[model samples]
Target: MKSQSTLLVICSAVMLALSGFSFFHRNKTATVSKKPVRVSSNYRIVIDKSHYELKLYDEEGWVSTYPVVFGTSEMTDKMMEGDRRTPEGHFKIIAKKLHPEWGHFLLLDYPTQTDLEKFNTRKSQGVIPANAKPGGGIGIHATRRNEDRFVDYYYNWTLGCISTKREYAKELYDLLPVGTEVTILH
Candidate 1:
């Protein structure tokens, strides 16, 4: 009877230890490297749609690169609403918010004056329907939790936003601030 009691205690302790380890492992955030480069106030971002990369830069130059996915496989400049294409041009981070599913979202100032002008030209030229509208609410954000494979596999599942892994989004959200310049290119 004493031996059975001892075995029960041992199993309980082992189960507790395993559960703790599993919790820690699941909650741990992955980093790009053992030591991440520090971001400065002069930081800027350049996203290359063709290359599926988001490169970070400071006044000093390139800091790091994060893998990213886009809204469409077309990889062209966004034409109209619901085109699923990511836009190309210079923009700025306008807002930051914590998202329930994607984790961190950095809203961009899309549909700038330049974008509007281009959109108008396209409409007049009949490249798009006269009634077509330019969409808004574009940004860079994280994939849903445990969905980092979307980025790794280049699945391109957003409506028009750029997406990275959850951890990378958190890193960017913590580092970048409003008014930071961002340039998206093909």
Candidate 2:
């Protein structure tokens, strides 16, 4: 009877130790994941659509690169409203918003004069439909607030914006300000 009682106590102690280890391991993982990425330089921002990345650079050198997802029509440049295509060009960060749906948004000054001219030229050449309108309101942002679990794992899933992980967007937002140069490439 004493041996059986000792065995039961040993098993119980082992189970308690394992439970403590699991709790500590889970907390450690959560802390690591919650830590934000560090971004120092913010001179220029470049988005490569084909590679699905956003690279940051300073006058001195390249800073960091973050994986990014784009609009559904990833390969094509945005031409019209509701096209679900991201524009390709040199733009400036015009605004920033903490949207209710979109977690964090850094609005870009898309549809620049160059983009408008391209649209006009294409219209004159009959390459694009005459009624097609150049769209505006493009930006870089994170996933929808409620859909955080599936933000950074996708290929292309935005309407007309660049999408990154929520933590990444927060880091970039803290580093970048309005009027930052942003260049998008095919």
Compared with the true structure, all predictions reach lDDT values of 0.87, 0.76
Estimated TM-score for each candidate: 0.81, 0.74
Q: Residues 1-186, candidate 1, lDDT per residue (tens digit)? A: 999999999998899678542211212233343235774799899999987888899888888888888888888999999998999999999999998877899999999999999999999999999999999999999998788977766777888999999889998999998999999999
TM-score of 1: 0.81
Cα lDDT tens digits for candidate 2, 1-186: 999999999998899678542211111111112223345445789998876678887766677787777776348888777788999999999998997877789999989999999889988999778898888878999877654444434446677899888887887888898989999999
Evaluate residue 171 in candidate 2 and report its C-alpha lDDT on the 0 to 100 scale: 76
Q: Which candidate's TM-score is highest? A: 1
Residue 107 displacement in candidate 2 (angstroms): 0.8
| Per-residue error (Å), model 1, residue 22 | 32
Q: How much does candidate 2 score in TM-score?
A: 0.74
